[model samples]
Target: MTDPSDAVEADRALKDKHRTMWALGDYPALASRLIPELGTVLVRACGVKGGQRVLDIAAGSGNASIPAAQAGAHVVASDLTPELMETGRRLAGEAGVDLEWREADAEALPFGDGVFDIVMSCLGVMFAPHHQAAADELVRVCRPGGTIGLINWTPQGFVGQMFATMKPFMPPPPPGVQPPPLWGTEAHVRELLGDRVTDVEARTRMLRVDRFARPEEFREFFKACYGPTVAVYQHIADRPEQVADLDAELAALADRNLRDGGMDWEYLLLTARRAGQAATGPE
Candidate 1:
């Protein structure tokens, strides 16, 4: 069995790997179709009022933060990886938006109580080692009547189905191992948020995943963007060459169903508003 500490570091390392690749400015180009639209939707859902202080948790490359700033909100973008936060800062500058960037952990925020009118995370909270604790922190720093919005994928959704299909080819951990809790289900999100938020809303959208026209492109994209899964694939396929074969098979599957120049993948958006009463400390 792998050491628990090693597993934790591996998770962070995998995220950092993606962060470095994302900093190279490839993801924005590849994810151009879905990312911008998703970012816009999340920002609008936050209902950014002019001059409102907003905390963007896990503001990877400033996808949602830039839009919030564009909407005239004062934004503080935070992420566990400094590389991502720096990349976000640079992107915001290029877009002519001013955003304060901070390096912080999602499970334990560095802000005071009632510091932000809105706290939002786009596909962020789900990766927390302690998701419920992170959720509590978001509520702790949000002012009374403030909103805590989260955007995450729903389990058993289209993307989840894709993962399930690919799982058989992936590697395995020791045994009886559990993956980190990502906000992939509505029920999980609800349970994490608990009674802190008075209003909860969720919306599902089909995100078009294009940019992979060839099998080789899919191989690079999947291995780069989905590193841990690739690690699993390397382990289970019994050899390195077999991993390439698996990618080819998946690419062929994707190619068979291409419509309107892109493959459609479903994603979910969830939003919740904190109560008007005084904020509750972390649970």
Candidate 2:
């Protein structure tokens, strides 16, 4: 029989590994420069107001958290990687905004039931290995009738295709770890959140990413700046031929996707209200 303590220890070890992986690349820069609009959009859509308590889970460098705070809401920016959260804290300070920053895991958030008015994540939380556990937590900490906002890359989107392309060269995921892009699908999220939420509204939006000057630039930049892309390359670093092959593949992908001086990545923006106050844990 499996010991409960062993399961707890295993999850902790996995989280530690994830923390290291996220801190490996220049994610804060990407979040700030390219997708900063996403955070603002989500905050506005959720109607974040002054005096509301907000939680930004998996908030890498406080994307959603900072904007919500700027809107006068009390925001807590929580993430697994302290290094990433530290960058957000510094940015918030410079922007003359204050946010409570905490190191946290999405599957097991360190907050009580129904403690927040709005819980949001921007291109975050979807990365949690255990999707159901994370989804339950999102519903758990939110007050009944409060909001939950999310932005995730769709499976048919450029970013999703990039991950699919990279999968062949990457290491196998641990058991029970779901693909992050699944969160972007409407039905998938609806199923995950289940009946614990109401007023479910989700829509796909196109985010034209014009960050790269040239098609090849996309591949090179991701290899250096994106944690997942960087990790994949690092894993195959010893295999020069494999690295060369992956380089060509990624460049080709960028070339195919790039147009009108940019690439269009699709994302889903979802909002729902928490339901029963007692439906915090999964059955």
Candidate 3:
């Protein structure tokens, strides 16, 4: 049997490779074009009023940070990947906004206590291995009464359904697989944050994502976005052409949404707030 650590490393490496490829294009404009007013929506959800010190964790390609900066907030954007940050910096610069971009992890933040008025992350904390530690870090750095805003995927809906369908195409893990649980669910997130934070409001926003423009676009996006899953097929499939068929099948499954300009993907947007009142109450 293959060692589990090797599998993890391989998967991580594959994801990193795909992320690099995805970052090669015009990131800011791509994001802007793909998700119109996404930044504005996220910034507003984060309660990022002007002049507030905001920390955007896992600031991938300025999905959250640029909007905050544009909203007149002093934003500190941090990410685990430097390449993503570089894209973020270039995008922010092009927008004529000065943002402090730092390379950091969600579990280990490099900030003083009670320094920020808002600590926000969009679709970031859910991927953390030690989600509790990440949640603590978000709270630790926020001033008392400061808000902690987050956007995570909810377990149900379209994205969840896609994962279920794609499971068969994924490689099998060795015994004792112990993959991380889906962290976007409301119950799971609340448990991860524990009882400390308050005014915790978790709601899902239905986001329509254009997964691809057409069948050809689907092929390109999958090759670009899906990493090891395709690599696995290349190795195990009896026939390589099976991969093409699989792509066609998936495109067909998304036919209603893909018939037009792009495939419609539903994304969950979750939001929560840090409590200023007694911690014992509901969050």
Question: What TM-score does each of the candidates earn?
Answer: 0.78, 0.96, 0.74
Point out where model 3 deviates above 4 Å: 1-30, 171-181, 210-216, 225-242, 256-264, 276-283
Model 3 error, position 34 (Å): 2.1
The model with the greatest lDDT is 2
Better of 1 and 3 by TM-score: 1
Backbone Cα, N, C clashes tallied per candidate: 2, 0, 1
Please write out the lDDT profile of model 3 over residues 1-283, one tens digit for every residue: 9899997786566446545533554444445555555566768877787788899987777888988898898999987767778878888888889989997767778999777888888766655555677778988887766777777644454445544545676666444322223555767767766665777776666666665666566545544444333454454478667676667666665564464555444444445555553232111
Per-residue lDDT over 254-280 for candidate 2, one digit per residue giving the tens place of the 0 to 100 score? 999889889889999999998865334
Model 2 segments beyond 4 Å from truth? 277-283
Q: Give lDDT per model, in order.
A: 0.71, 0.91, 0.66
Ranking by TM-score: 2, 1, 3
TM-score between model 1 and native: 0.78
